[model samples]
Target: MKSSRGILCSAVLLIALLAPQCFAEDWLYTVRKGDTIWGLSHKYLKDPLKFQEIQKYNNVKLDRQLPPGVTLKFPMEYLKFAPAEVSVSAINGEAYFVRRGVRATLNKAHKLVLGDILVTNKNSSVALLFADGSELLLGESSELIFDVQTKWGETGMVDSRVRLMQGSAEGRVEHLRGPGANFEVQTPSAVATVRGTEFRVRLDKEDDGIVFNEVNEGTVSVQLHENKESVKEGYGLITSAKLPLAKPKELLAEPKLVNPRSKYLGHPVTLTWQPIDEAKSYQVELFKDKALTTLVHKAQVSSHQVSLPEVNLGEYSLRLRAIDKDGLQGLNTIHHFTISPVPRSPQLKAFDEQYIAGQPLEFSWEESVSATQYRWQLAKDRQFRNIVTQQELKNNTHQLPEGLPAGTYYWRVAAGNIHGFGQYSTLKRFDVKRPKPPELSLSDKTITTEDTLTVDWQAVPLAEQYLWQVSSDETFSNIVSEGKSQTSHLVLEELPESELYIRVAAHGPYNQGRFSETKSVVVEPEGNGKTAFGIGSILLFILIL
Candidate 1:
């Protein structure tokens, strides 16, 4: 009887040795009927003398009888058999697991067994990590079974296999360097076998039990019934339970921007892109940020171009994607841009006034915000039929070049930036007045004892009156006579006999013209007394005759 009992104890101990143990921690046990402290120590620790230590740790009386349904704590040295299970590495939203027909909510750090079934609710996801550093990510509304096999007394090389019943799953299989090691994901329609690869497998119930497999990093072989295809990186395959496995196809590359490659700030912007192979349509989205979180505009078009309406002015981003015939969207290509309103029209600072000819006309305008330059034009007519001067100036003011003709001129200014020019300001009119001097002439150059002297001048256009001046000095500082006349002729009642100077000028409403050339005249006194007596005798003879 003792021999048989010893053999039974050895078998129990051997079974305990084979099971995994909790690493560096204590264990808890519940007491059952016919459980004594010494018997429990001998069964768990193989040392009956440790019962006194257990009693001291639990504060139990050794002489008293042991009671059933009592809880006892054992140290790590006395406990064995810590089961190996998968761990929940991450969880998003709501997820649950069914282990051995018992349902529980899934959380980070939760352990899962071989037959454990993980389920993700709507908008929920979870990631499972195996001991060999492999990962399986269950997407929303997905169901997966974790089937992992680990070699006894080994540290690595786990055979990882997952059965996806519905929805999508992404896996990153770690490389195993041992014999009889494998990693695979089996769906309802197809099975994906991978080694050290990053892949995604999805099963759609609405698509008649179709399975989609995509490899992102390494090669993945998709097997469906009697047909199989090896999908490389940047490739995908599709299969259905009712049909044969389809060949792998290359994914669509990112689209390139054809227009507005840099910053843009205008209305009705037309965005264009390079077309991709096998693309049925394109989706273009505009965001207010580079991260594409704030959507400003979104549109889908069959062509490769789309026109965006006016939006608020600020920074923005443009994202484009090609849509295949099967409604699958390819990778997104995002480009940044800016939106700014056109600059305001510049306000002219000049007014309708008269300026002298040959003087520089300084044109100025109000400074517009965010304007980089200004454009101005000078025209002779109101309709700009005769453009005299047009220039692009960097500053708010510009000085007209010298020697501009005297006439009525119209001018306007417009503000501009990197985008384009804005509306032109209201037209401003200005006149340059420069009246010519009248040409003066004398009827007689010499006048001796004359009763009257007359000075005449050529008529001047737009001259309301003429000004005549007689001066003794050449510089006309000592004016002997000065008068204004309505006509071009002027009569002097009396004139000095000495050499005299005469000049004329034209007077208009806006300007007083320069003086004309001076004319000189000289006068001589009468002869002596002898010449007077002879003249008296001749006068008497003529009276007699």
Candidate 2:
């Protein structure tokens, strides 16, 4: 009885020790009354293959299943995680500070020096916030810094701040996340902030006296110092030690003129506006009769010059608006000017005249006011592409080149002035005439007797002489006579015995005009045929008759 009681006590001690192990919980776990080894294994261990692990841990047989009220140790391989933070630094000598509800972009890698701010926006204008929940917006040619960095932790925490130095810029505070996240912009004299909406702020490098702020879209509360303060909107707050957020009524300060004679009536014009009251830059708006023509120029400049090319006769005006770094415009102003037209085109006349072949004529024309040069083009065809002469003449006259081929020629001239060259004059046509042809008449049409052949013709109209020939086969190969100078007919006293052909051509100054029709004649003795002399005489009479 004593041994059984001791065994039972030992069994109870072992059960208490292995209660957690038998349950299969990897970490600490308090045993519950209804929990069993199988239930605990399924709940904690999960893997069915590891069900036997409980038996091995307790030094019990596999067949001897897990018992209730036993402890077990479990391994730790399952859990969940979260995203880390991003690392950032500053650029240039600018410092940064950040808290919450702020965002911005860093220009380069840097260590934070000053300014508690965070990135509120990264767009055309970067927004930054201060520890006091103030806001600053950066425009083009602007730089800023942030305070928060990834070294502490990278959990997307609002950590950095920024500052705007040197260039033109704007700032606005929409809504602060809390009282701790206050936003502000620091210049030489004033720190500006807004309760809601948008506003602009600017600072100058050379002189701190030019620091100014404007509330374009929202209300801005400004503090020049702890003692002095003011709020401005739809207007600007100009600040210095003397004036703390003071409101000036008239702001349309005159812009300095840069090159006065920058453009002419026929030249391109460039107009530039000057910065006013130490403002960072200015904008020039050009108008033609009150209509906005162009926002001609914008820059951080003291003056601007506009170019106008070939300005017509009209009235012109230019209006300018001065802008601070905050994008606020001052009163609109105007600069008036005038433009005039140049003189009319010059006149030209091409004289008409006839010329002989190989002879040239002189061409001249009148010039108009302001005519500086003349252009002459001459050609044989009307198209003028076959230009025989394309010369720029300082004088209004040019003699046509001699030895031009015999043909009708066309020519014209143009005048050039400051504005442009005028249209060419009407083309003039001239002729180079060739010599004329002579008139001619033939001699005789027929011949009867062999011994005598009488021929007759008339004189050529414009000829010095006539070219005459007589042939037998109608080809005029056998010439009875060469060119004859006589005006009347020629007698072929010693004529050929065979039939003959005769032709007469007229020669004149130009060419041979026409030729007489060919005439045929048979030259055979009439006598000595059939009673010779008497029969010849009778045949001759019969032929003649």
Scored by lDDT, the top model is: 1
Which candidate ranks first by TM-score, i.e. highest? 1
Worst 10 residues of 1 by lDDT: 148-157
- Which residue pairs does candidate 1 place in steric collision? 20-82, 21-82
Candidate 2 runs further than 4 Å off:
1-162, 177-181, 242-245, 248-281, 284-320, 323-545
Q: Per-residue lDDT for 1-545 in model 2, tens only?
A: 99999999999997554222132223433445675546556654536356567546545553334344555443422111121122231122233335343543454342233333333232233333333333443443444443222111111112222344545455444464322223455565776655654555666556655666655555667766664444444566667756645553233345666544322332234555444665655655444444322222233443444443344545666656576555446545566775433332334464656764445568887765567887888888998888877888888888855535456888887676665565566678888664332333334444445455566666543455777777777766666655564565666666756677767776654335356777777666554264577767888999998
What C-alpha lDDT values do all the predictions have? 0.74, 0.51
Question: How does each model score on TM-score?
Answer: 0.39, 0.28
Cα lDDT of model 1 by residue, 464-509, tens digit = 7888888888988999889889999888866766778989887764
Candidate 2 has a TM-score of 0.28
* Candidate 1: residue 222 Cα off by (Å): 1.6
